[model samples]
Every structure is written in structure tokens, then in C-alpha cells.
Target: MVFTKKKIWFSSVALFILVYSINFMGYRDYFPLFLLPVLGILMIRSKLSKWFLITQIVLLAFLVCYCLMALYYGYFSFFAILGRLIYPSMFMLIGYYVAGFDTPKNLKSFSILILLITGSTLYGMFSLIKTINLYGSYENVMSALGGRLIEDLWGNSYISATVLNSSVSLGLSLLGLLFIKSNDLAPNKRILKIAILSIFLASIYTSATLGNRTGIITVIVSFFTIFLLKLNSNIKGIIRLIVFIISLYILKLLFFNLNTFGVRSYWESSFIFSRFENSKVYDDPRYEAWTTIIRNFNENLLGGRQINLSVNFAHNLWLDVFYDAGIFPLIFLVIFTIISLISLFKLLKLELPNIYKGLVIGLYTAFFLTFAVEPILQGFVVYFTFFCFLIGIIQRKLTSATY
Candidate 1:
């Protein structure tokens, strides 16, 4: 029995490392993505705890409701909810990985993750450059050719806001450099961190698209939060936070009007707010979405009616959930989020470096804002899986009296 558990443990770890190495290369499709969960479950005895089982059943109930709605509406053919399950089903295996292993040092783990990001970005940039040289601007680039080229070369969408959000938030490499500088690690480690951050920053700017500015600004805020959080909670620390907030206020004064402000976007004419004074169309899509959830409350309480409501994406995740599931899912979501945050915050008693705390806190902070406008439920599995595992890591550390 002991030998068997040992083999499962080691094999599962090996599988995780192998799958993680493939990283961006195999992220987009089922075979590679599904590999993790399948291996994870096989190694772990094919049984999750009753807690997870019950949770799955709950989600299953939601699924049945959705399927019934789909059958009623005649849109259940593609097996969408079932198909989408393919993504999380893969990561659920990873959750078992977290359940078993301790969190390794932040340095190597995050370095591997960021390295994949930097590599993918470079691949995308090179592809873009080649396409431009061969076919010129977007006007000349054919969608079929461009898509084939994007998938073949980069594996995922380069300009996706959620993808860019992770790379750009606190600058993956930049925070890595801060880790090196703060920690008394060897000189080579320090240099590696700095070098990685430099490449990451350049790539983020190159990948800039519509909402890039707000994302960059959020990164700055989160980065500053990290630096300040590191300072002892003395008068000096409070002053630093104060200064940071003021700077953010100024930035908001300048730009928040353009993109979304808590699930709402101002008219594109924010610069000329005066010109559109009377055109009060506060009716953002979120309101309509919210109404949908409210209306469906009696029939579909646990989540939305599992029908094929979204042909593609909700475009806005927060509003979509609120609309589909009513006010309760948001409440459940917020509570679960608070649990994650509070758990991590207590783990901070371990006094993790400002760099790591900043990295975790900043990324969560950035995602909090980003998800307001986009559903990252479909983003780099690397991001979602890594974060989930980190939570498990922190919980384990706290429980083991590591502090």
C-alpha cells in the first residue's frame, strides 16, 4: 500500500512537470490540456473527497438545468457546457496535484511560468513581423491565413486582454527582478530575474491593444501596492500607500472614463464629456445581463438555466454571471474570493517577500479588475491552474506551522 501511494505521488508529480513544460505549446486544445486531469486522477486513486464530490454534484445540477433549457431552446448540439468542461476537467486533475505537493520556492516555479509567457510573446511577435513583411498591414492579412499562422506559431490569441493582463500585470519579469533584488539569492539568479522582466515589459508594450493602457496602469498600482506592502506598517508605510493612491487617483482622473469602470464603460467621447452631456445612455450591457439573472431567479437558483445562452462568450464575465445566476452567484463568488484572499493574507504572516506577495496580490488585483470586463475562465490554463495551486500551497504552508 505504501509503495503504491509513493509511486502515485512521484508519477503524478512527474506528469505535472512534463505537462507544465509543454506550457504554451499545447495549451489551446483538448489532448494536451486534458492530459493533466486524466493523469492526476489516475495517480490519485480515482476518488476526490466527498466535499469535491458534493460540489461536483451541485455543478452537475446546474448543468442539468442548462441542458434542459438547451433542449427547450434547441441549441444543445455542440455539447458546449460539456465541451467547456473539457478545460476545467483538465485543471481539476491539477487541483489534486496541489492537494498533494507543498508549494516550492516562488523563484523557480514562477520563473518557469514566466519563461513560458515570454517565449510565447516572442513567438507571437516574430509571427506578426513575418506576416507584416509578407502581407503588410491587417488590411492585407487574410483572416484564414492570419488565424492559421497565429495558432501554428503562438498557440493562443496574442492580443487577448486576459492573456496580456497576466503578462503585463506587475510585469511578470519585472516582479521577478524585484524578487531577485530583494532576496539574497546568488548574483546569477538576480540577473536572470532582471533580464526576464526586461523582456516581459518590451513584449507587453508590443502586444498593446485597446484596453492595454488601463491594464498597464493597474499593474503600476499593484506593483506599488507590493512595494508599499513590503515596508513595515509604520508611518512611512502608510505615507507610501497614501502617495500611491493619490497617483492612482490622478491616473483615473485621466483615463478610467474611457474603458470600464466597475462593469461599465463611459461613452467613447469621455475626452469630450461636455459634448455628450444630454445623451445619458447609462444602459450598459451589464444591466441587461443583470436583469436576465434576476428574471431567471425562481426557475434557476443555483446558477443560470444551462441553456446555450452564450453563442460564444458573455464578452463580460461579471455581468454575465450576475444576469444568468441572479444576485446569489455573485454573492457566492465574492464570498469564495474573499475566502481565497483572506487565506492568502493570513499566510502572509509567513512573511513572504514583497516580490511574491506582490506577485500574487497584484495578479489577483489586476484580474479582479480585468474580469469585470472579460471572463478569464477561458484564458491561459497556466494562469488559472497556477493560481489555484498557489492557494493550495499557501493553505498547506499555513497548516504545517511553517511560519
Candidate 2:
């Protein structure tokens, strides 16, 4: 059956929403298991570029070599090695299929769908918050809300906020960038757009209230990145952005005092004040992990150490990959990242719609920033999958434009 491009795009969007919703509902394992076969079928039907095919071949080759090394050394179980390969493979296949049907409108639609899913998850978080009393401490509130506060090896506590919070923050930040860059909306739709923007901003505020530092950081960094990227070309635009940022800070201070919004206290307690106080005591786990990995380099230079060598994640993507799969796979990952960034940079230079470009930049930067704090590539497979799909869509657009 020949499906129109619109039909295919809509189908892909629906599937994405379904998978994300299931993920938010705490069925991440089962949903991906079910979704992979469907994505494989879509990939089989999609026409892919030669470069994409070559890239996949290289990635697969690296995975094969890594798996063989792991088996040879008994470093990881068969099931463990297979699990590591599955997500990236799923990302490549689903990304190819979605890219085949990508269009500016489809991208916008998919982004809005993500926002809606984020809204649902935010509502769930709020419901949990409501069950706790006003006097509850942050730890108590977060404990009631689900997700644990883990202590690193050095005895520093870290909030491992739920995936839903991170996803909501990511969606809200991207949606904000899209809204700010979109100048072509109908004049009559101004109020509607403002309402939607307000909702997204409120969700961001909710993320802060829930002690999800990553979400708050993503929103701040994304907006700053978009402002600089979109406005740096003109003197007036630069001046306007500066004034806008100043005014925003002033307003934030005023609201912070009034506590008119629930966001201020939490933001102050969780991020601003706590971060400063903890700075003297908190030795970042990522730094420690990287140090340990380097110290053990000779032991795991070609083949990784046995899985029993460490019970904790490396907490940095590059370090994690290097520790788990050895130097060859780490080299392959670095090469893949460099190539993807070059392609994305070229796409950014194109005459695409501002909102589309902003979305790509925002998502890419946010995802990359996450690698410094978590082994996102290994654990947050769903987010990584979406990032890969966006990469593929951007590549497809660039290819079409060149032709």
C-alpha cells in the first residue's frame, strides 16, 4: 500500500507520541521492545541516501567489534551487549523512515505533539505535588513525587529527577525557541500564541518547582542560545536582546521577592543557593569517573574491563563509551559525533524557516549539554532516539535543498 507523504508523516508523529507517552507512564522497557519491529518495517520501506547507508554500516561495524571484544574478555553479558546495541540501531532505522517524510509543517506538528505530551506529564507531577503539604521539605516532596536522591561515592547527594521532568523541560524549551523565532504567524492568532507560550512558560516554572535542575538549565540555556543566534546579525537586534535580558532579570527578582509564583522559592532553594553552598563540597561524579577511567586506561585499552569493574555509570557519554567498549568504539563514537555536527552546521546555514532552525539548534545543544552530567547516550535511550530522528530530518532537508 502506497501511503502519501502526509499520511506517513502523521503516522510517524503518532507513533512517536505513543512511545513517549508510554515512556512517561513508566513502561519504557516494554514500549521500545514493541516499537523496534515497527520501526524496522518502516525503515525497510523508506528510501535512504548513500551517505546514511554508509554511516549506518560504519556504526554497525563498530558495534560488532565492540561486542566481540566484550565477549572475548567476558566483560559484559550477551544480553547486556545486545541491549547496548539496540537503542542506537533503533535510532538509525526510525530516523531514516521519519526523515523520508519530513517537512517544515510536519516538524512543527511533531513539536506541538511533544508539548502536549509534556503538558500531560506536568499535570501528573503537579498532582503529586498537591498531595504533599506546604511545609514539606524538598527531599520529602521529591520522594513523594517519585525518583530518588542518590549519593555519589564521595557522599554528595544528587537528585535523579524523573525522565518525565527532563522531557517536559526539553519540550518546553524547544517550544519556547520555536515561538520566539516564528514571525510568520497570522496577526489574528496573536492571543492564541500568547496563551500557548504562557502555558509552556508555566510548565518550565513547574519543572523548577519540582527540583528538576536539568529542565531549568535547559530552558535558560536554550533561550539565551536562540536570542544570540537569531539576533546577532543586527545592531538593533543585539541591543534589543540585551535590554530584554536585563528586564527579565529585574522582573525575576521582583517576583522572587513576592513569591507570586511557586517557581521562585524552589528555583532559589534547588539551584541558585544550594548550588553555591554545595560548590565547596560537591566534587562532580563525572570528574571522578573520568579520572578513574583514565587511571585504568592500560587495563582496558583494547578490550574493556569486566562489567564488575565498576557498579556506577561513568556519568559522561565519552567516558562511559570508552570504559564500556574500549578505545575503538570510543573512536567511532567521536567520529560519528563530529560528522553529525558538521552536517548540522551546514543545515543551519541554509535558508530554512527560522522556527525550524531554532528547534534544531535548541534540541542539539540541550542534548549535548546533558552528556556532561549523565551517560545520556546509554541510559536515556528515548531522548537519544528523538535526537537522532531530528538529526536525520535536518540531514534530509539539507539534501533536498542541495538537489
Candidate 3:
């Protein structure tokens, strides 16, 4: 089969969707292995922009420096370093194609992909319902099913049915809502638009049910940021905003009234005063992890210590960078993040469509929030790749003389 540009593009998008959507299951841990061939294909066929290439080179150089230092320290493991590099490297490749190829079409495809993900998550929620019905409690259901479950400070169980996948779904739903709001649909297309909106609402509810504070906060922040930024100026925007608020209120009431499987009460409790009062204790582990990493820092602050440490990551991106690769790499990562934010802000200032701006904001907010709770650049492959893709898109737009 002839692999034309269009074919390659579609194939890449399909692979992305497959990897991203199936993450609701437990298979995402091996996604990097499956993504290897796709990355190779993308590297060979995709066109790269100058800035994107430069960014990759800098990251590659840093990785090489870090690896050599680890080797000298007798902690070098080829596969270990390779595993760490896979997602970010793949992200660069994703960004390359996303920037140089058909962007608008790819964006549309991504919108559809997210809708599919929302549907899959809803299915998972329903499955959880079934499990609860059978087992009489979330804990009993998880015990029977046997998977990771996180309990919040209140002893309320939160299922990792979708794990980190909820973060991506939340970002997508925000972007999808913005897209739907900004676009004018034909009478025939209104149903489809409504369906997408309903799915977005459901995705938010599911994120809340999953009990990932970061994911829930990301969705809320992204929605309001996009809403205030794009919709505050117009009367129609205000009406839409009111409608959105009412819809959310109604959804919350429905969930509260139904109170199925204790999910509603658990979610509601997450927002109550006691949750905030006990937040410091709830965040104690993360704080202790950071303290441990800092206390264990070796003398070589430039090249970092060996990767053989028992506690590998710090859970926070900045602290993790410092712990894993030392102060130099930490500085580099911070600079990169600052530059990405500046670029995104510049892109937002451009006279682009409201939908495009909203998409950028959604991606930016999600990535930023993830850094606080997840070592996204280190382990969360989907989100890391998505962040890099958004960066690539922003870079492409900023550098293009036409825009």
C-alpha cells in the first residue's frame, strides 16, 4: 500500500485515538512499546518545523548528558533511560506532524476522538454501577474486580477505573464544549452538538466520580477560563454561560438525588468544608515525598545522582526533574515550561477564531495542572504527548508569517 501523506496522517491520528481511548482499560502501561513503530513512521514521514527540531535537539542533548552522568555513577540502565525518553520523544514527533500537516482537519478529528473517549468513560461508569449493584459497595466491587483504588481522606473510595485517562477526557471535553459553542451548526447538526455537550457534562461528572482533584480542577478552570475569555463580551455568550451553569446545577442535583453507589455523596463531600480543612493531611504524602527527595540530593547538582534510587519520582514535576536529573535539568525544564506558556499566550493574542483560542487554553490549563499532581513529562505518556502536540501547534502558529 502506498503511504501517502494523507494516509500517514490518518494512520497516525488513528493510532493516537487507539492508544488514548484504550487507556480506560489497564493497557496504557504498555502504550510506549506499542507506540514505538508509530513514532518511527512519524519521524520518517512527517515534516518538522525549525523550532520544533531545535526543541527536540535540546531535550535530546539534556537526556544524553543525564544518561552519561548516570553511567559514570554506575546506575546506567539502557532500557530504563529509553523508557523515560519514549513518551517525550514521541510527543515531539506528534508535534511535528500536528504543526506541519493538516491542522484544522486534525483538530476536527481530535474533537471526534475525544467524543468517543467520553462515550467509553460513560460505559466504564455504567460498568462501575453494575459492579456496585452486584457487590453492594464500591470497595466490594473493587475487591471482586481487583484493580487500583484510591481512598480519599474521608475513607471514601475512589475507583481508578480510568486512572489518568480522566485528565485527557476532561481537557477534550472542555475543548469540545468550546468548539461547539463557537461554531454555527445547521438545524440537522444541532442534535449532534447537543450530544457532544451532554457527553462533555457526563465526562465532567465522571472526572468528579474518579476523585482526581487535579482532573476536576482542570476541567473547572479550563471551562471558566474559556468561558470568560471567549464569551464575556457578547449577550449570546452570557446566555450560553447561564445555560451552562444551570445545566451543571441540574446535573449535580440529579446525581445527588439519585445517589447511586455512593458516588454522588462522595463527590459532593469532596467539595465540602471538611475536605478543605483536611487537605493538608491529604497532601502530606506528596509533601513528605518532596522532602525526602530534597534531603537525599547528592553533591552533583549539575548532572544529578544515579537513577537507582528506590524512590524514583517526586510526584511533582519540578521536584521530580531535580531529583532525577539534578538542578541543571530542573532549570532547563522550568525554562521550557515558561517558554511554552509565553508562546501559548502569544498565540492567544493573535486574531484567531475563538474555538482555536479555546483549544489552546484548554490544553495549556490541563498540562499546567497536571504538573502539580503528576510527573506527566516523566510517566503520563498520553498527556505528555498531548502537551507537546499543543506546544507544537502553538509554535507553528507563532512562527508562521501568515498568521
What would the per-residue lDDT of candidate 2 be over residues 310-355, giving only the tens digit for each residue? 4377776777777767888778877777767887788778766565
Best by TM-score: 2
Backbone clashes in candidate 2 total 0
Cα lDDT, all candidates: 0.48, 0.60, 0.58
Report the poorest 10 consecutive residues by lDDT, candidate 2.
Answer: 150-159
Per-candidate TM-scores read 0.61, 0.75, 0.68
Clashing residue pairs, backbone N/CA/C < 3 A, model 3:
none
Candidate 3 least-lDDT 10 residues: 148-157
Cα misplacement distance, residue 174 of candidate 3 (Å): 1.0
Mind giving the per-residue lDDT tens digits that candidate 3 earns over 294-332? 775665375454333445556777776666567766666
Task: Name the TM-score of candidate 1.
Answer: 0.61
Clashes of 1: 5
- In terms of lDDT, model 1 sits at 0.48
By TM-score, the better pick of 2 and 3 is 2
Model 2 CA deviation exceeding 4 Å by range:
1-9, 24-26, 32-45, 65-83, 103-138, 141-165, 175-206, 252-272, 280-282, 303-311
